[model samples]
Target: MENKDKTDWRFKVANREALIGCGLALLNFVWWFGFAYGMGSRPVEEYSYILGMPDWFFYSCVVGFLLITALVIFVVKVFFKEVPFEEEEELR
Candidate 1:
């Protein structure tokens, strides 16, 4: 194929993967910062300990969110290679 077509395909694939990564990161951020914290009125200290753990257990949530997002992004980049529109016909 032409060199321009090859370049365009590479560009499109890169953009598609980047978009996916950004979306996942945003979702993680919202879940951890918005849903978890927004609903809570008082400080974590006001709550009783759970199973000997402190009420301010939100640090774990932050770390877990980061780890999960990293794994998801890695999996998306490794297993999901995007195809250009022109190549769709070849799949048939």
Candidate 2:
């Protein structure tokens, strides 16, 4: 036998938002891991120094950081929706 409640789970918008956020988070993690690992594996002598750090560190840690920062800002501004979660009323 199946049981149902007044709140139909299928109509929830939060699930979709959560899924998109989790997907983006996973993508960001992969991006960081791949670049940082690729850069870290190279010999120290092969990379030129930037700000007293290896070129790989400079690009992977510093520049990649800036790119991700911009990406987050853009996504938050353009893609993220302002939705009232169902819990707002319950908390009061």
Candidate 3:
């Protein structure tokens, strides 16, 4: 039996990816909240429309969703690393 080091590369990679995911989630929330509340706070009569949808809805829900989707894809493809799950056998 053997004990693995606490500072394994796999652990470091996992932690970094987790932090990046949390950051992206926070960014998404902030984007949604800002646009949804900032523009939506105005009176209905003064609201603007884009492609038949309210400006706030279009930007906050539609565009924000697309932007976040693209960002996540890019991050995963570029920054994330594939880690092996199998344990290594000790050399004799």
Candidate 4:
């Protein structure tokens, strides 16, 4: 009898895991890009500076990046499930 588990293509543990990983990664990328571009596009010298860095740089690029990084770390730790990888059969 054929192994239904091996032949089943409708759903896969690896595929689901990969999809979740890719979604999270894409979400992070979009968030960082939006932060960088949205803040970087504002008028120059509009706000007070921090440590000689522009407010946008200090807040958006530096602090914002840190915040987003932490958020991603938290989400991954809390939401991602650790799935075991399936072993492939060796060809005869």
Candidate 1 lDDT over residue span 62-91, tens digit each: 554677668796877686685655633433
Model 4, residue 72: C-alpha shift (Å): 1.4
> Candidates' TM-scores?
0.51, 0.65, 0.89, 0.53
**Per-residue alpha-carbon lDDT of candidate 3 for residues 16-39, written as tens digits (9 for 90 to 100):** 999999999999999999999999
Better of 1 and 4 by TM-score: 4
Supply the global lDDT for candidate 3.
0.94
Model 2 lowest lDDT segment of ten: 83-92
Tell me how candidate 2 scores on lDDT.
0.71
Candidate 4 accuracy as TM-score: 0.53
Q: Given candidate 2, what's the lDDT at residue 7?
A: 61
Candidates' C-alpha lDDT: 0.63, 0.71, 0.94, 0.68
Which prediction has the highest lDDT against the true structure?
Answer: 3
lDDT of 1 at 86: 65
Model 2's TM-score against the true structure: 0.65
Better of 1 and 2 by lDDT: 2
Q: lDDT tens digits, residues 20-61, model 2?
A: 678777776776777668877878667678899877777777
Candidate 4: which stretches are off by over 4 Å? 1-47, 88-92
Candidate 1 stretches greater than 4 Å from native? 1-7, 43-48, 51-79, 82-92
